[model samples]
Target: MNNSHLELLKKLADEFQPRTDVNTRATVEAESTDAFATLVDLARDMQNRLDQQQNRIRQLEQMVETDELTGLYNRRGFLRRVRETMARAARHPENGILVIADLDGFKLINDHHGHAAGDAILRHFGQNLRTHTRADDFVARFGGDEFAILLVGSIPEVAERRISDLEKATSRFPLIWQGAALPIRASFGFTVYNGKSDITQLLQQADDAMYANKHAKRPHSESSHNAA
Candidate 1:
């Protein structure tokens, strides 16, 4: 019963037993029983509220650490993890690879198909990376069409092969946008970190390598014209 009904019952029971006399013992027992029931109901309601609050907190935590669109780790989350990994690496130095990649012709795609299509392609790319990488590997969309991956316990050669595999995967897979198939490709650059280099330096090196790869792949005529 509701609190109001329980209160009314208690009132009637009290009226029947004005004082705690032995003659009204049965009535007092009934009133006490009703009060205990109300207390039990209140406790249950409070527990439910507490559980709801805990669930909300968990959702908030996930939102803080994850990108809403691609479901990858956000910049903040990625950096935090990098720091932790670096600390561990310092304790036990091993081969770790950092790879940076950017979607080729992404600007054209965005310009032609609009941001929605661009977002869909990015989400697809992120899912592909997650599928190919191991559980120990870290992947995040740095921003826009750029992404970064940290492969733990991997050498430079393995890193290169993995990145090449990723590029092939993306190139072969066509992203469907608005019932149309859209071609996508990516360029990658990677550098191995030996647990002694600064994170910033490692990122810069990877970025430089990515640009070098991009430049190397450009047509000779374009390069010559740009030089002019």
Candidate 2:
């Protein structure tokens, strides 16, 4: 029940109680019976309000953990799950894998197109990730153009393969903006956590791997100019 309703009920009950020992011993009258009935009605109303308040609280909690834009878990929600997964992994070892991914040339897409297009790309990416992953997997938008996925009961190899599959699926999905097809791609890096490692360190390793992938794919100045 909501605090306001509970407080009101308490106030009414306090006020209705006999103020003295002599009053408590007096015989009940029709007016007194009517007042008791009113109190019963008030109590029922208060109970209903309390039930509504509880339902509202659950909805608010869900919204807090979800991302409004991409419809995925936001950064705050993602970290909360990470902590929970880490705790579970500590107890069951080798049961969790963390993958970090970022869109390739996302800046170029934003610069060439616009923020609106960028947003569409992010939304599509999120949808694809959700579609390809298992129900037990946790996927979230870590930040702009960056996403993280936690695979429960998965090894690094399996996680990598899942990421690769997602990449291929995403590449095949064309984004139509302003009646034009925009090509999209992503790079991913992952590491397996066995419950013994710090969450921060594991994330860093994945991040490092991602950067290595990006650097390896980047063209040298000569190659760039030649292409131009």
Candidate 3:
């Protein structure tokens, strides 16, 4: 809610409340520091305004970090948060897993159906991914049709399970847009954090693994997407 609205409500509450047989003006005069009290009130008012400005600034920052399309973190937010998470995971006993995912036949989906339909699928898939992953896990859209999920304090099996669940989810629910049932196909490759000094190298490793898996399975359907 807006700060102005909050202030208005507070004003109404103060007016409605019943007060005892004590007068604010008489109290101020008895204190013999009316000027000082006024200064304190001014300072408090300034502080409230400052607090409101700070809250607005924080909201704006969150908007910057979020992806407008899918409500996931954009690449910048992903890198910023995941870097810290990975650093902590490196020191902790349990390691982390990074999965690089790309949608197969996404271009075709965009080409056949309008971009609106394409966006709908992406939003649905992104929300589903958010629901499926653990709360501590970080999910982000790495631009275009690519996404990344960082499973903090997790193992290879957790990443593997996510891939399997993703495949099963898409298969189970055929996305329907404009009276046409469309398949949400994707490919995923996972790389475990091995106490590497650089996190980008781990990302590169996952990307390479994804392509290798994609190429190896391309023969079956040429465009068949795999969650393997």
CA RMSD, predictions in order: 11.3, 14.5, 16.3
- Per-residue C-alpha lDDT of model 2 across residues 1-228, encoded as one tens digit per residue: 899999999999999977875555454565688899999999999999999999999789879988888999998888888888888878877577788888887877788899999999999999999999999899999999999998888976777788889889999997999999988788888888777778889889988888777667777653422221
Off by over 4 Å in 1: 1-58, 222-228
Provide the lowest-lDDT 10-residue window in model 2: 219-228
- Pick the TM-score winner: 3
Cα lDDT of model 1 by residue, 10-48, tens digit? 999889975757758888898999999999999999999
TM-scores for candidates 1 onward, in order: 0.72, 0.75, 0.77
The residue pairs in collision within model 3 are none
Local distance difference test values of all predictions, in order:
0.85, 0.85, 0.81
Worst 10 residues of 3 by lDDT: 219-228
Give the per-residue lDDT digits (tens) of candidate 3, residues 1-228.
999999999999999876753687678676778788888999999999999999999899889988999999899889988778766756774578888888777878888788998899888778877888889889998888888888887778867887899777866676888788898877788888754546788889989988786676566655443332
